[model samples]
Target chain A: MEFRGGWDRCCGEARSCRMLNLGHGGVRRLSTVDFPQTTEDLSLLYKYFAANQAALTRNMKKNKQLLEEIHVDLDIQEHLKMQEGARRFQQVGLFCILLFVGSAAFGLYGNGVVSKKHLTKDEINIHFERFFRFQAKMGLQIQATNDRDISISFPIQYLNHFEISSIVPEPTETRVEGSQVKYAFKGRDELTATFYLVPQQIGQIKGSVNVNENTFSISHFIFP
Target chain B: MNPVLRGIAVYLFVYVIFRILGKRSLAEITTFDFVLLLIISETTTNALVGEDFSLTVCFIMVCTLVGVDYIFSVLKTKSIWFQVASEGAPLVLVDDGKPLLKRMQQSKVDEEDVMEAARLTQGLRHMTEIKYAVLERDGSISIIPKEKK
Candidate 1:
């Protein structure tokens, strides 16, 4: 006789009967509890899971592609903005460089020469004493050297307070050799004097002079 | 004997002691941790700078402490039970938007403190907006928002 039951009741009855008839040899023939049956059920479940996994993977791949596209779009937008910023910076940089160069050149030419009268030896000496005393109070030592041919008296001051040391009249001079006076004072001491001077219609003077060698050169001549 | 080596040894020893104290020690950081740190620093400083101190002893102590720390870190990571025991479980201070006054008192947390934490983290102006407020293992408050849908 065949028995009919609802799916839940049938499943429940099957579980109970399998448990009760566990040791009986006839149970194997009546029941679907063998390894093969279990394997088959598992295979079907595996297939279902595999298919679900495949679908999930495909969805994930699509999502990743979408995200990558979005990232690329953002990167391109950022790149374009950066390029615009760089262009503006370049324009500004060019303007600054041009302005700097032009002003520098004008300053070089403006103060290039000094046509003023040369200060006499006595007058220079007096000025030197006053300058030396002032500088000595500020912790500096001055040494003077006189060269008659050039009418130049170079007073080398040891500016212990700063970095550079030379016997040059800086920023102002009567004789304009590229915005500087060529002056040197030499005495019994082998201490060489250097000259630095700036000419009034000429640019500033910035160069070293060798008093012993009577040699002078212009480093920078800014024309105003 | 070198000042540098001594300093390093002291630093290592201190690091190990602190590590052994665990994360909860840092989270709570009571007057105890501060005092411990101060005493440890004071004791170790003389040894670190003194010529009489042995570098070998210092390094050995440091290595031993560091080993202990490593073991604890490994155990905490591998065993969930150990992690829970070391860190402690979260205390529920609020359930269903209602404040659990007993739990708050037990946890040593006041209503004002909870409110401030909620406001700072979630902009929760009213207690009614909170679904659940859990005091986490780290002594920080975790809030769960009510399900809207």
Candidate 2:
């Protein structure tokens, strides 16, 4: 019988409530002894059923074990295989949910996939949310090496993709040099400048922090 | 949060959840099933809309939802395995007026449930009145009445 589930209705027209399945392959024949309903026969039926219970249970168990053998379950090897498949698919779906939540849940990962790198030259320890969602506020920390004047220039790509929401310890001078936005901090020792950045666009955004001659390139993916 | 992605996510998540819940869940066998469905719909609506109330977001959400559904339909047609995996096959619950107790138990169905369906579908008042009862993939019991004398 060509039985259609709720989902199967989508691909084709609605089926009429008539079954025309003749000699369906999944059918299994069973033979059972019928008992009479007379009071004396009923008492005898009870005794007979009690005696047959163990054999009945054994037959059912054997059928279950045979179905569990996988390859031997015949064409329609019982619905157990299908249930197993559905369970496996559910596990996969759950895994996807776990990954999605793990990578993007707000504050769950504490600023989201933080990347801390200590530059050898400028001693600029850049700690930032390397992975974040679109429009989500991400923290970017940059520390200067020793007590010296430093100018951090954000590349054009960064300016285009991310909007600088706020800056800590105001830069002495901020200027737009061509495509890059430059923030200059003069006469500062042991300075850690934090940039509160919000991604304006989604997907992987390539950017660079130019500290004098040293350029620290950063790539972050913003989920939509 | 983009409503388009959120819409798609909500749709797929609900679909998978419903699949895992099994076809019987769709029957909403009890009054409380409706309350559970309402709660789920409420959460999904919030997730799909978020803080965005713009018409553009609404349009994107609708399009994404419809598009994903279309894609799934196409996949189902293209792949038989996808069809079977998603919808499952029908199971025989009763043969020749005798209840297949093992199959019925595995499917979470009882003789009362099958007889209820039989009465509704074929006016079959007893197990002997039914020739065959199959638990269709959609979770509905289809009963075939025995040949009239």
Candidate 3:
């Protein structure tokens, strides 16, 4: 028997195929010249995919119950395959949900990134997002055991990338020492500095942050 | 902040969140769901457009979002696994007039939700009237009546 459907010929026979219009622009073929005499004919002739646009959505159940004894293996096989895939996706989705929550909590992109470092009875901490869009604001703080003198140095590359927006408890002296700039705050025990950085370049930007006699490295990957 | 990057990040983040939330998120939304969606969009606008109120900046943002979506669509068509990965597979929620309680509870769908769709679409009165109820990948409940008219 010849089929009239759209596009590709599913029966693989050389005949004029035009679809009866099922769903998703697929061609559904029906033979009116000869009624479906066998179960095979019925299986190939009658198959429908109903799209649900309800407020409450659910998965497509393979409803072979319409022709129970006939057992049309048409939509069921594909839907069942999809059903299996749908079932498996939940597990993958759950894992990704945990990952998303974890990423945000750790402050990779969303929030919560305040890292602290200590050296020589003095400690410095910065509130920074590990992964941030280019030109995002970040802050730096330093607490010293002795309030005698604190000199925070930033490398020339760091200076080039980040525009220092503001410095709180203004530094007594600011000078370019060697390859880095030193901002000295005399006798200031606790100091906080803010950088309203407009990134001139993207990708991994890493540099040494020298605080007084000690040095530590800070690195950040900026996204475009 | 980079508007294009911001747009891509927001799109991917929202897509993943909705995927985890389930098909109901993409379905014909309820009143509260639509409200929440509006709030989310409003909040996202600031992050996406930022202080750069220029037209070109907003254009770049829109381009980035649309470009990412088109790329995903291409991938979905090219790869079956990608199709399933991006847009999840359809699931069968009911069989032979019996509600699959485990799957229903897991998906946060109750009998009433199914009945609501059935009533609206198939004019179905009761659970017994439904031959099969399938939850489509796009957050739609496709119901098949036991007695087809």
DockQ for all candidate structures vs. native: 0.02, 0.19, 0.10
What residue pairs clash in candidate 2, if any at all?
none
Ordered from best to worst DockQ, the candidate numbers read 2, 3, 1
The root-mean-square deviation over C-alpha atoms between each candidate and the true structure, in angstroms, is 26.0, 11.5, 11.7
lDDT tens per residue, model 3, B24-105: 7668677998899899999989878877899999889889999999999999999977787667665566664567665676
lDDT of all predictions: 0.43, 0.67, 0.64
The reply for model 2, stretches above 4 Å from the true place, is A1-84, A94-121, A145-149, A186-189, B1-10, B24-52, B63-149
Q: What's the residue-level lDDT of A100 in candidate 3?
A: 67
DockQ: the better of candidates 1 and 2: 2
TM-score of chain B of each: 0.63, 0.91, 0.90
Model 2, A25-92: lDDT tens digits are 12221112231335564455344444555555687486643222112222343456666566566678
lDDT of 2 by residue, B33-145 (tens): 88888888888877787668789888898899999999888998998777767776677777656676766765668999999999888888889777678777788988877
Regarding TM-score, does 1 or 2 come out ahead? 2
Q: Among all windows of ten consecutive residues in candidate 1 chain A, which has the lowest summed lDDT?
A: A66-75
